[model samples]
Target: MKNFSTKALALVLWSVIFSFGGCAVMDKNIPGWSQYRNPDKVNELQLASSSIGEGNPVLLIHGFGASSYSWRHIIAPLAQKYRVITIDLKGFGESPKPRDDLYSVYEQARLVRNFILENDLQNVHIIGHSYGGGVALVTSVYLAASHPNLQNSLVLMDSIAYPQDLPDFVEVLATPGLGPLIIYAIPNTIQVKSLLKKVYFNDALIPQSAIDHYAGNLDKPNAKYATLTTARQMLPTDLQQFSNNYASLTIPTLIIWSKDDEIVPLEIGERLHADLPNSKMVVLNDVGHAIQEEQPSLLLPYLQQFLDAGTHRTAPNSK
Candidate 1:
């Protein structure tokens, strides 16, 4: 009887540790995590966000596996002229990554729309990269009827606006049992570096800081689960239906694509440009899918001109 009781206690202890361990949040100590975390919860989730400057609001969204850190280079400059807000989509960055299997693009867009409404952001411009671009597109569609002026313009950089084959990493993550094991086998730094190489046109330009920033807290089991779940549900069930709706969006849009973006491909950008009623597409040579990280300087003039044409010019006093 004594031996049985001891075994039962040991089993319970192991179960408790495993359950808690699997549910740990992404490490909040990642550089800039505290600096950008939003105190207010949008819906029920405490989203990580940074808001700076003051004018017509410009919200920036990062891609899959990225935090607000992805816009680190351009946020300051944009904030100088506009109220720049960058958010980590649910399950990414400092945002709460609940194991709740609800990381769809539509769900992400819903959160973004609420964030805009909750903050009372007006005459907003949305900029999204890769997966975030898809969210931005969906958000724009959602905003068209009720808050047209609020979401006035859009800027998409190598965005995932249309259906396409999944990237190698995405495919691997979307796999059932084997996916998690494969990703977990590699060290976080190594995994991040490997993925970065695939996105950046010139691997030589990849920095150590980038590797460290993106690799933050990925070792946690929740992070892995969130990533896997996101990959599996990256595309909506009615993607063609959604793509058909792109033509209905009349907002002024700037679609920037890298000539060497093997991930989403330049042809998709061309197709997206053709679909939108009012959109201008720019294709830059030699950059990869991460055009923001690679050639932000090249993007500034276009961004400044586009925003100046449509948005309020007066930037309010700094906060």
Candidate 2:
């Protein structure tokens, strides 16, 4: 979770993939294969993603515990207007999880930049939700500073941008002795699954299959440690600072917040819009922090419009 410095910062602080047992740990009950069978031929899912359309480039960034799958609803429609790309940040999903102290927002930003460069993606638009929003902001600053003229637009969805300090809940959750145990029991997949009910305004938005898809990835070899270490070491305030650095960007920007968000409040979104010189804010009424899921129909068209039309317009009644 990432956000600006404020009382609501504590609120936003709250927040994968299904991989089978490894070659050695495969279940023995399966038909004829050995108990320990290779899960599949694939190991590390590259940063590059499946694409759609041939127009402008759009990168979709998923929030905490969510993999490329989180963009399921948006990708198809977004593909109608532009090339849509979704990636699993290093520590989450099928992506490579190198546990050699390699997890950080900068590292993730670097990886994404490298991917964009590797693919020669230009005039790219970043659309991120929650934790991914922080990464998107970092990517924008890094790309604007280093690559210049790469980022064309930014869409931050109920994200954590400016960080004041640790919230009381997180402080207690991160306590020394207890933190380890909590971290151990609640791995990436499980942590996300457990939080899903509260994360989405409507629990029905997340089906049982979705929960399974997320929790299943926790078994991936180094996945657990990668997520925990990143949290303990990579402070979000570091990423939030990147926003201040991007105040001069010429890229058109859009900020979307949910009025009823229990997680990141509208204040963070509003502050971000205020701080960013080239940006607009769209707040959705009757929704939570996870506005996309709580109200996908509300966000989808606006996103499609922004990407296709390159203009920001409120839904008039969004409030």
Judging by lDDT against the true structure, name the best candidate.
1
Candidate 2's C-alpha runs over 4 A off are 1-48, 165-173, 186-190, 234-241, 311-319
Weakest lDDT window of 10 consecutive positions for candidate 2: 17-26
Q: Using Cα atoms with residue i matched to residue i, what is each candidate's TM-score against the true structure?
A: 0.83, 0.76
lDDT of 1 by residue, 1-319 (tens): 9967765654454334333333212222222212212222358765788899988889999999988998888888888889999999999888888998678777788788889888898889999999999999988887885677677788988888766777776766676654676556556776787788889999998989999988885855588888988887776655666787787788888899898897898888898888987888888998889877877888888888888887542322121
Question: Which pairs of residues collide in model 1?
Answer: none
Tens-place lDDT digits, model 2, residues 267-303: 8878887777778788888766676665678899788
lDDT of 2: 0.65
Model 1: how large is the Cα RMSD against the reference?
Answer: 11.8
lDDT of 1 at 272: 88
Which 10-residue window in model 1 sums to the lowest lDDT?
24-33
lDDT of candidate 1? 0.78
What alpha-carbon RMSD in Å does predicted model 2 have with respect to the real structure? 13.3
